[model samples]
Target: MSPYLKLLFYLSGISFAVSFEIDYSNPDVVEYDSNSQIEKTEKVDLRVYYCSFCGGCVYFHTKQLDPTLKKIGSYIDLKNYPYGLTTRYKKHGKIYFDCAHGPAECHGNKLHACAIDILKNTTQSEFYNSCMMNSTWGGEGSSDKDAINCGKLMRIDSKPIIECANSERGDAIMEYYGIETDKVTNPKNKHMPLILLNGKEFNRAKDLMKTICQTLTKPPPECKSYF
Candidate 1:
């Protein structure tokens, strides 16, 4: 078992059956407009709370994370919450969202939500997400087609994602993400990409692999270089 996983098992004193249910209306998520920024595991349980249109998120994924995937990816289990600094309110049996980046960003968030839920696999969805997000770095606007195109590139069926994105289900999913993020203390994550490792906020500006190694209760061989 991975050391991180062992730590998880030790701390919980139970099986590692973590749930991914989307939980509420609002969270203390930082929103990036031209805007903000923000990774994985099969071993380290990692969660990223981010928004689709955040430039910081895009740059982090495209520049920092993409190249690092091969080094430390095997030891991680990753998940993404695509709603950031977004709020929702229910009225007359319907939920409405107000996103910082406008309607297009809301749409982008829905696409990501649908992809993560519909694909049903964290790695696959992350790849799909990475592709779509990386596109924006090249000055691509109108993110829908690019995101969908990324899905297709992975040979993932985009139909379900598209359907979910345009429907109420997508909104509900976004709402749930908002709820999950709400559990995080507001104002703590003052910048884009609020990352949690082992359910605690991860604060660091070091190399990704090294940071994980340092955080582990028992460092693995792969982490030797950092030490």
Candidate 2:
């Protein structure tokens, strides 16, 4: 080939290589918002306290864990939460621990779509506005839908006292009632929310319901006691 022709071919090859590298490094076809003012300025570390199996919970946890530390501006460090999304005990599958990756992980892309929308520009008030919390027995289907709808409706109502006091799942029943948290103080026991008050004359569930009722202009009628 002639000198000019050879030079043209060489430059074409170089151009192709550069273009390929650029595409490979940044695979996302759509570009994110480029405005620096609205972009997160710094990364902040957040210790997540909820189950990793729930996408909504994980979404909040990730957003709170500012990504700027890695120069990425608000991202999560999966390596940190070893007991992530799938650490439930073998004997008692109802309880789940924590984990970082995999489809089973709480933050799997499927469940967090709505949450992601809220996270982008919605505030805490907005988030709560879209939730619905119910307290009942023998409900069909899963809590995932309830969590989603409750999030959409922004209402949280725990189980009645009777359910809380008598349910076979003691910790779950208490959590639903907002009266007590499972004790994790003992090393032998898995991590669970701490129960603040003893289940005596001071009914934590009733107090929480009262607080909720007071907060809204129109709250639910007097809370029904389980006992």
Candidate 3:
């Protein structure tokens, strides 16, 4: 990994460790002891591997996942990777990329990666992402411009994000996301926006609330029905 990639991993690693995990490996998969074993609070690790321009991915995140986080945000440690099904290669001393949805998607994916790196907080970055995704919800916004507008709306400085997304650092981060996405074998990554809860495949979107509710040793009040 290049220096930038290492830095991105380092940043994410620090945040992950603060969440009360015992064993951490791939960004996509991590295991933790039940909160009972640890005096400090433990969090369920949530990982989502997605591509930015996939309509289904966008809808799931912006429409479904965002709302779900509102209730379980405190109980979860979420990591969102944005290069699903994208490939990269070095050509003529420059790194190039091929994405599932073409160049536009690749650009969007890189933009997402940049946002993650610059913001350094998945939830905060996701808000930025939700903005960009929703801006293009009707297929109307350019990736770069949407990022800036989202940043403005969210009161974030998007200048660095723009520079990183258009630079080699962006390519490096995208590559990092690709490597992380490859570690997802449980659901076999059959599709983008593949969800992993506590290192297991979680396919039931409707049961998301209940699942998280039941997973935690002490379920939250929002999951009252599950009690």
Candidate 4:
């Protein structure tokens, strides 16, 4: 097993099992509008699955895309899913997740999910960027307070997100993401961030923009400028 998966097993103290199965035939994808309002004649779907506390994920996927997003935003509909790199366990007859970066990261994931629920697409993007800016990989980077702080920085009311983070809804979303991660076949891969463009996995973070540009059937003006 990979070090990450080993860590998971160590934390959970349970053998890996397919606890449940989901309909992988249809994956959840969310479409977002660009920062610009320019109507595009052609568009492609871009999906990113990420763990907030993964340093590599934050550095390569979140921080690196801000500039590229400005150019390709209109040509691509971006959807980001927060995948928690955590293990599930039963404690006192209650199930709990042990996040790699601790409870703060888990809380941050819930915050992001709640933001998606209450904020507009553009706002969601902004909120994600802000939260990521506060994140650290492989450790307890951003705390629950930091998540709320980021929301406030974006002028988003943090109450709803905080409430959601503390509710059963938050637990369900995290569990759902855990299931999604399991769908990936790589035995060594136990963490985030994973990217998929139109149902195809894009493994390398450095090649993300190039891959997206190449995947576009009807190349936008931005594609020409990108390459």
All candidates' TM-scores? 0.73, 0.22, 0.77, 0.69
lDDT ranking from best candidate downward: 3, 1, 4, 2
lDDT of candidate model 4 versus the reference: 0.57
| Model 4 Cα lDDT, one tens digit per residue, 1-227 | 75334433432335333111111111121134643365644556666667667777656543445445645666666666675466777678665787777777777676666666556675255334444334322234345565554454445576776787788877776677667666763656555667666777667545666767887777667668556
Candidate 1, which segments miss by more than 4 Å at Cα? 1-42, 136-142, 217-221
Q: How accurate is candidate 1 locally (lDDT)?
A: 0.64
Mark the regions of model 4 whose C-alpha exceeds 4 Å error after superposition: 1-41, 90-93, 120-132, 135-141
lDDT assessment of candidate 2 = 0.27
Candidate 1 per-residue lDDT over residues 1-227, each given as its tens digit: 75334433433335333211111011111011111122122366677888887877765554445434444555565678888888788899999888888888888888889988987756556656766665422344326676655544456678888889899899889989999878874875755678777887775355666777777767667788878
Cα lDDT, all candidates: 0.64, 0.27, 0.69, 0.57
Tell me the deviation in Å of residue 58 in model 3: 1.1
lDDT digits (tens) for residues 93-209 of candidate 3: 888889988998888888889988887766667767766765432353338777776665566788899889889999999988888887774454568778888888788456677
Candidate 2: regions farther than 4 A off? 1-43, 52-85, 88-142, 151-227
Give lDDT tens digits, candidate 2, residues 45-75.
2222233344443333222221111122122
Which is the leading candidate under lDDT? 3
- Per-residue error for 46 in candidate 4, Å, reads 2.6
lDDT of 2 at 38: 53
